[model samples]
Target: MPRMLLVTVLALLCSACSSGGDRYDPPGLREVTAANQCMEQCQRHFDSCMTSSSSVDSSDRCGAGVATQRDTRCDTIDNPDLRKRCQASADYCRNRLPALTCGENRSRCVSRCGG
Candidate 1:
Protein backbone atom coordinates (compact mmCIF):
# COMPACT_ATOMS: atom_id res chain seq x y z
CA MET A 1 0.00 0.00 0.00
CA PRO A 2 2.87 2.44 0.76
CA ARG A 3 4.59 1.62 -2.53
CA MET A 4 1.38 2.34 -4.49
CA LEU A 5 0.90 5.66 -2.66
CA LEU A 6 4.49 6.68 -3.38
CA VAL A 7 4.07 5.93 -7.10
CA THR A 8 0.83 8.00 -7.24
CA VAL A 9 2.49 10.97 -5.52
CA LEU A 10 5.50 10.80 -7.85
CA ALA A 11 3.22 10.79 -10.89
CA LEU A 12 1.32 13.81 -9.64
CA LEU A 13 4.52 15.69 -8.91
CA CYS A 14 5.95 14.91 -12.36
CA SER A 15 2.78 16.12 -14.08
CA ALA A 16 2.74 19.30 -12.04
CA CYS A 17 6.42 20.02 -12.79
CA SER A 18 5.91 19.67 -16.53
CA SER A 19 2.82 21.90 -16.76
CA GLY A 20 4.47 25.33 -16.66
CA GLY A 21 7.07 25.34 -19.44
CA ASP A 22 8.17 28.68 -20.80
CA ARG A 23 6.26 30.12 -23.76
CA TYR A 24 8.06 32.07 -26.49
CA ASP A 25 6.69 35.07 -28.32
CA PRO A 26 8.54 35.98 -31.52
CA PRO A 27 9.27 39.70 -31.85
CA GLY A 28 9.88 42.36 -34.54
CA LEU A 29 6.86 42.13 -36.82
CA ARG A 30 5.14 45.42 -36.01
CA GLU A 31 8.20 47.49 -35.15
CA VAL A 32 10.09 46.35 -38.21
CA THR A 33 7.14 47.16 -40.48
CA ALA A 34 6.85 50.66 -39.13
CA ALA A 35 10.58 51.25 -39.37
CA ASN A 36 10.65 50.07 -42.96
CA GLN A 37 7.77 52.33 -43.94
CA CYS A 38 9.43 55.33 -42.33
CA MET A 39 12.72 54.55 -44.05
CA GLU A 40 10.98 54.28 -47.41
CA GLN A 41 9.46 57.70 -46.98
CA CYS A 42 12.84 59.14 -46.10
CA GLN A 43 14.38 57.47 -49.13
CA ARG A 44 11.72 58.93 -51.41
CA HIS A 45 12.35 62.40 -50.08
CA PHE A 46 16.08 62.01 -50.62
CA ASP A 47 15.54 60.73 -54.13
CA SER A 48 13.23 63.60 -54.94
CA CYS A 49 15.77 66.08 -53.71
CA MET A 50 18.52 64.44 -55.72
CA THR A 51 16.45 64.50 -58.90
CA SER A 52 14.91 67.98 -58.70
CA SER A 53 17.66 70.05 -57.13
CA SER A 54 20.93 70.82 -58.86
CA SER A 55 22.61 71.97 -55.66
CA VAL A 56 24.93 69.32 -54.35
CA ASP A 57 24.78 70.92 -50.92
CA SER A 58 21.03 70.51 -50.75
CA SER A 59 21.23 66.87 -51.79
CA ASP A 60 23.93 66.21 -49.23
CA ARG A 61 21.83 67.80 -46.52
CA CYS A 62 18.87 65.69 -47.55
CA GLY A 63 20.99 62.53 -47.53
CA ALA A 64 22.23 63.33 -44.04
CA GLY A 65 18.67 63.84 -42.85
CA VAL A 66 17.59 60.54 -44.35
CA ALA A 67 20.49 58.72 -42.75
CA THR A 68 19.69 60.21 -39.37
CA GLN A 69 16.05 59.20 -39.62
CA ARG A 70 16.94 55.69 -40.70
CA ASP A 71 19.42 55.16 -37.91
CA THR A 72 17.04 56.53 -35.29
CA ARG A 73 14.16 54.39 -36.45
CA CYS A 74 16.23 51.23 -36.84
CA ASP A 75 17.84 51.67 -33.43
CA THR A 76 14.40 51.42 -31.85
CA ILE A 77 13.86 47.95 -33.37
CA ASP A 78 14.53 45.04 -31.02
CA ASN A 79 15.02 42.19 -33.47
CA PRO A 80 18.42 41.79 -35.01
CA ASP A 81 17.06 40.60 -38.35
CA LEU A 82 14.76 43.59 -38.74
CA ARG A 83 17.40 46.00 -37.54
CA LYS A 84 19.90 44.62 -40.05
CA ARG A 85 17.43 45.13 -42.86
CA CYS A 86 16.84 48.74 -41.88
CA GLN A 87 20.56 49.38 -41.60
CA ALA A 88 21.17 47.77 -44.98
CA SER A 89 18.63 50.05 -46.61
CA ALA A 90 20.12 53.08 -44.94
CA ASP A 91 23.59 52.07 -45.95
CA TYR A 92 22.55 51.59 -49.53
CA CYS A 93 21.08 55.06 -49.69
CA ARG A 94 24.05 56.71 -48.05
CA ASN A 95 26.51 54.89 -50.23
CA ARG A 96 24.63 55.64 -53.40
CA LEU A 97 23.85 59.26 -52.67
CA PRO A 98 27.06 60.57 -54.19
CA ALA A 99 26.58 58.63 -57.40
CA LEU A 100 22.89 59.38 -57.89
CA THR A 101 22.15 61.30 -61.06
CA CYS A 102 18.89 62.80 -62.32
CA GLY A 103 17.51 59.34 -62.94
CA GLU A 104 15.34 57.39 -60.44
CA ASN A 105 17.28 54.18 -60.17
CA ARG A 106 16.60 53.13 -56.59
CA SER A 107 16.85 49.37 -56.98
CA ARG A 108 19.88 49.30 -54.73
CA CYS A 109 18.15 51.23 -51.95
CA VAL A 110 15.36 48.68 -51.61
CA SER A 111 14.63 47.38 -48.09
CA ARG A 112 15.03 43.68 -47.33
CA CYS A 113 12.91 43.80 -44.17
CA GLY A 114 9.89 42.43 -46.03
CA GLY A 115 11.67 39.15 -46.43
Candidate 2:
Protein backbone atom coordinates (compact mmCIF):
# COMPACT_ATOMS: atom_id res chain seq x y z
CA MET A 1 0.00 0.00 0.00
CA PRO A 2 2.28 2.76 1.24
CA ARG A 3 5.31 1.15 -0.37
CA MET A 4 3.58 1.05 -3.74
CA LEU A 5 2.64 4.71 -3.48
CA LEU A 6 6.20 5.61 -2.62
CA VAL A 7 7.48 3.68 -5.61
CA THR A 8 4.99 5.37 -7.92
CA VAL A 9 5.91 8.78 -6.59
CA LEU A 10 9.59 8.10 -7.07
CA ALA A 11 8.96 6.97 -10.62
CA LEU A 12 7.13 10.20 -11.42
CA LEU A 13 9.83 12.35 -9.88
CA CYS A 14 12.55 10.51 -11.74
CA SER A 15 10.67 10.90 -15.01
CA ALA A 16 10.48 14.65 -14.49
CA CYS A 17 14.26 14.90 -14.28
CA SER A 18 14.73 12.83 -17.42
CA SER A 19 12.43 15.08 -19.42
CA GLY A 20 15.02 17.83 -19.69
CA GLY A 21 18.34 16.09 -20.26
CA ASP A 22 20.25 13.03 -19.21
CA ARG A 23 19.35 12.53 -15.56
CA TYR A 24 22.98 12.70 -14.45
CA ASP A 25 23.87 15.77 -16.48
CA PRO A 26 23.59 18.79 -14.27
CA PRO A 27 23.13 21.99 -16.20
CA GLY A 28 25.76 24.74 -16.76
CA LEU A 29 28.64 22.57 -15.61
CA ARG A 30 31.88 23.65 -17.27
CA GLU A 31 32.76 20.02 -17.76
CA VAL A 32 29.44 18.42 -18.59
CA THR A 33 31.01 15.12 -19.59
CA ALA A 34 33.10 14.89 -16.45
CA ALA A 35 30.17 15.77 -14.25
CA ASN A 36 28.05 13.19 -16.01
CA GLN A 37 30.67 10.54 -15.40
CA CYS A 38 30.97 11.40 -11.73
CA MET A 39 27.21 11.53 -11.32
CA GLU A 40 26.84 8.10 -12.90
CA GLN A 41 29.25 6.60 -10.42
CA CYS A 42 27.45 8.20 -7.48
CA GLN A 43 24.06 7.08 -8.82
CA ARG A 44 25.24 3.50 -9.17
CA HIS A 45 26.56 3.43 -5.61
CA PHE A 46 23.32 4.94 -4.30
CA ASP A 47 21.09 2.58 -6.29
CA SER A 48 23.05 -0.46 -5.23
CA CYS A 49 22.78 0.52 -1.58
CA MET A 50 19.06 1.23 -1.88
CA THR A 51 18.27 -2.06 -3.60
CA SER A 52 20.32 -4.06 -1.13
CA SER A 53 17.83 -3.33 1.64
CA SER A 54 14.32 -4.65 2.20
CA SER A 55 11.21 -2.45 2.64
CA VAL A 56 11.47 -3.20 6.36
CA ASP A 57 14.94 -1.68 6.40
CA SER A 58 13.90 1.56 4.65
CA SER A 59 16.35 4.47 4.29
CA ASP A 60 18.16 4.35 7.61
CA ARG A 61 18.98 0.69 7.30
CA CYS A 62 19.94 1.27 3.68
CA GLY A 63 22.13 4.16 4.80
CA ALA A 64 24.18 1.80 6.93
CA GLY A 65 24.67 -0.40 3.90
CA VAL A 66 25.83 2.66 1.97
CA ALA A 67 28.50 3.28 4.60
CA THR A 68 29.66 -0.30 4.40
CA GLN A 69 29.72 -0.22 0.64
CA ARG A 70 31.59 3.07 0.68
CA ASP A 71 34.46 1.52 2.60
CA THR A 72 34.80 -1.48 0.34
CA ARG A 73 33.92 0.24 -2.91
CA CYS A 74 35.77 3.52 -2.57
CA ASP A 75 38.92 1.67 -1.52
CA THR A 76 39.04 0.05 -4.94
CA ILE A 77 39.65 3.30 -6.82
CA ASP A 78 43.41 3.61 -7.42
CA ASN A 79 43.50 7.39 -7.29
CA PRO A 80 43.59 8.58 -3.71
CA ASP A 81 41.80 11.85 -4.51
CA LEU A 82 39.07 10.15 -6.48
CA ARG A 83 38.73 7.55 -3.75
CA LYS A 84 38.19 10.32 -1.22
CA ARG A 85 35.66 11.98 -3.49
CA CYS A 86 33.74 8.74 -3.89
CA GLN A 87 33.58 8.19 -0.15
CA ALA A 88 32.46 11.74 0.47
CA SER A 89 29.76 11.47 -2.16
CA ALA A 90 28.59 8.24 -0.56
CA ASP A 91 28.39 9.98 2.81
CA TYR A 92 26.37 12.87 1.41
CA CYS A 93 24.08 10.62 -0.58
CA ARG A 94 23.44 8.28 2.33
CA ASN A 95 22.64 11.13 4.67
CA ARG A 96 20.01 12.59 2.38
CA LEU A 97 18.72 9.57 0.51
CA PRO A 98 15.34 9.51 2.21
CA ALA A 99 14.57 13.11 1.31
CA LEU A 100 15.96 13.37 -2.21
CA THR A 101 15.02 11.87 -5.52
CA CYS A 102 17.70 10.17 -7.64
CA GLY A 103 18.00 13.22 -9.88
CA GLU A 104 18.46 15.43 -6.87
CA ASN A 105 21.05 13.00 -5.56
CA ARG A 106 22.90 13.07 -8.86
CA SER A 107 22.78 16.85 -8.93
CA ARG A 108 24.26 16.99 -5.45
CA CYS A 109 27.00 14.57 -6.47
CA VAL A 110 28.31 17.12 -9.00
CA SER A 111 30.33 18.56 -6.14
CA ARG A 112 32.36 15.36 -5.96
CA CYS A 113 33.52 16.14 -9.49
CA GLY A 114 34.47 19.66 -8.45
CA GLY A 115 31.60 21.04 -10.50
Task: Flag regions of model 1 displaced more than 4 Å.
Answer: 1-64, 97-115
lDDT of 1 by residue, 1-115 (tens): 9999999999999998889778787667897787688668657866676655555544254464787788889999999999999999877765564435433444434443332
57, model 2: CA deviation in Å?
A: 6.4
Alpha-carbon local distance difference test for all models: 0.68, 0.68
Best-fitting candidate, scored by lDDT = 2
lDDT of 2: 0.68
Residue 35, candidate 1: alpha-carbon lDDT: 64
lDDT of 1 at 92: 71
TM-scores for all predictions: 0.35, 0.30
Backbone clashes, candidate 2: 0
Error of 1 at 73 (Å): 1.0
TM-score of 2: 0.30
